[model samples]
Target: MDKNAATDAAAETPTQDTAQEPPLAGRVALVAGATRGAGRALAVELGRAGATVYVTGRTTRERASEVGRTTETIEETGELVTAAGGTGIAVPTDHLDEDQVRTLVGRIEREQGRLDILVNDLWGGEHLLVGSVFGKRSWETPLADGLRILELGVRSHVITAALALPLLVRSDAPLHVEVTDGTAAFNRRYRENLYYDLAKNAPIRIAFGLGEELKEYGGMAVAVTPGFLRSEQMLAHFGVTEENWRDVIARQPDFAIAESPHYLARAVAALAADPARASRWNGKSTSSGELARVYGVRDVDGSRPDALAYFEEVRFSGKPGTPDDYR
Candidate 1:
């Protein structure tokens, strides 16, 4: 991912309640796929909230990796987490490999003894994008390829949670956050892509199913979606800088309703800190905008951009222009 993009986006917004108490000082957390995007930001935010975080991903300092786009190393994310005030452990892992995932969790269990939070963000869907589009139709795409996306996006989460369950079950306040796209019920156009939609929607099901299964264990599982995430790579894709991102709305109208990954990170941190969070959102798929409203946290610009609402009230209204015009 574009480190520059993240740096610029974060710099544009004033810091949030950094002086507040660290609510998760003793908590042990893990953010899978922490190399970039929402996962990377969430790891740092958790650290800011005073939780030791294990940041795991395929990209590492030792070797150049192949998700084939801009890459962020696990060590980089870990360092950011540490800088944010929580202990950060960089574990280079490919979640699709069950053995690798098991070993990673084993190490965490050995050292931490208990897992307080697990954020399953293992999406290597970049591989599925052939020239910025799905390679084939839903049925046309090779079943194996589709299955691979599901394995990385959904199954890896299950395997990691299964391996870490014993430790999580022992924690006083265990929480599982399944990072995903918009709600399955909402079902936007989704680029008319089949496999991508399935992969994106799978996490919602996983969150709900896991919530039901883990309820007896006193754990909560909820899926979350970020707004039109203005990632470094995305900014580059739209040919805009964070300082001038508002201008991109002229071309890609939806860009006006963007949120930095850190916005979602803050939301996740807030939810994790709330002792009654599970009771409020267990088994639900929520958006960053919705969470911001519930928790009263602001985005990077100190504004709570209710992008979901914009989509519903404006984009869905069959207006003459695209989402960007509203900005």
Candidate 2:
């Protein structure tokens, strides 16, 4: 048996949502690439909403993933979920490997028997990736690397969807979230480099394609982005802790509107629990801040930082403004 397989453990009810039992109680979710950042937080949030989440990623205690940046592992993420009142199962999976991903889905079937939500938050394939890890001009990018990146960034997503389709369709109105770096509107401009731009935009396209296919089955798919995410890597790059992330604004004012990974988690949790209109967001590109308005969930700081709005109004407009301008 795969160490990742479950043992028919009893389901748990999230106690944090004091108003009532969590809407996702007894639900099962698979959060791919959940070792860190938005994926980690999203898995935790699903747990908080009373969902049994199988968290998969390459980073584990026994091995460091290609990200080479953090010790955060999928096991730690699962532990956090369990602590938050939902079941968390950790599975180290390399999404690019068809055999590994296939076995993962099979384990889920043997254990949980159903998969209700599928969040394709895959990344962390830089070493195995086809393109330059450092953003390079299209002409300058090595052809082999560029093609491999297409496999890592784009093909991995399709592989997951193709394999998970059977399990996902079993649930009523299953929700699939394809996490991307930017909204479709924002990615219209170049993003540092050609490969990077395409990689980011690919997820949105995947969501659109899946949205079209899933509609017939009464399921939904959407591309989601976090507003200027203060992910672990970003925070490390800025040389600040989440406790003092404000310090980064002095060097990069755009950082002022940065949101935690949990913000994206809130957006996902809200969508999953929305029994009435979650499908309305299908084929759309959304952010945690915008979804805050629809779902009424705030960031850890209790304010919704609309990063895209801030970028357009303050960054692109060449105007200086406080974070409040966006919040």
Candidate 3:
């Protein structure tokens, strides 16, 4: 379905049963990189749970951030969060800068008094520079370019997390989430992209390291990934509209089964609601499908797009495909 169709369908559906629950009422959350994609969705989901959310990102109406591609802005995300039933604050920030990140958190502390959740969704430009791919080597692209990607993808998250730690530690049920892509064990050079692989891997390690470090403070840290995210940017890249997203399955069969950002957002909400969630997911990296099973919540379409299972089944069954085979 296209965005309009989905919106209309949502309008027709009954109100969510959890609308009255307010699992996170009286809580404050900070979602870094909330301008678009997973970060934006997570902020809205947290809001649905009844938490005051601070949505920070570099992209704004006045000026665009490092990544030139445009979608929603932090202000737009904040509005969505507020519409979901919580107060939303949009703060323009570039996470790559340590001082900016610190200031962002300091302002949150001043306004909210305490932080309950922190989600680091910063990503470098690996996916953005798809044109640079040459043969099996990502390094063949450029040295300086790769380093720049590292700064945004890896360093930004580190800096933001460092600045937010003190405030997170002060919260009664502190939760930290590092967002990344895919699983660690499934690591196959990923189209032979060296910097991209490392940047993605680093977040998982950060989660594990922070999980151990925060043990003393009774805090939890974990990494989360979405399966085949059908993001607005990705749909535009593929020349497909959400209404006809299934059309891309012909080009990449796995694309047929895509999950919306809301799927992962629900996962974060479930984790925040669970009192024992820290013990279960601390230091671990999990996927949206896995979280759906654990939380018993459906995706926006009310279907569980189990991308992992689809991959496994295809691999075992030896499905035949080409760029347009699944179409």
TM-score of each: 0.87, 0.90, 0.88
C-alpha lDDT values of all predictions: 0.81, 0.83, 0.80
Instruction: lDDT winner between 1 and 3, please give it.
Output: 1
User: Candidate 1's residue-wise lDDT over 1-327, tens digit each?
Assistant: 256745665565435466775898899999998998899999999999899999999878776455755457889999999998899999999887789988988899889888999999888676566743375677777777777777777788778878777778788767988998787556555745676787778788888988887788888999999878887667777788779888886667677789999889998999998889879989999988888878877676666676776787677776465444322
| Cα lDDT tens digits for candidate 2, 187-281 | 77787766667888999988888888888878888899998899888788778899999988888877878899998898789888887644568
Candidate 3, residues 1-327, lDDT tens digits: the string is 567756664565334576376888999999988888888999999998889999998888777776775566888899999998878899998887778888888899888889989999987374546656434376486787677767877999889888899989998778999998866654443635677777788898999999998888888899988878888788887898778888887777768678889988987888888999988999998888888878865578756666655554464456654322211
Which candidate comes out best when scored by TM-score?
Answer: 2
Q: Clashing residue pairs in candidate 3, if any?
A: 1-243, 2-243, 250-326, 250-327
Model 1 lDDT on a 0 to 1 scale: 0.81
The local lDDT score (0 to 100) that residue 206 gets in candidate 3 is 95
Provide the lDDT at 279 for model 3: 87
Comparing 1 and 2 on lDDT, the stronger one: 2
**How far off is residue 233 in model 2, in Å?**
1.1
Off by over 4 Å in 3: 1-21, 124-128, 133-138, 188-191, 316-327
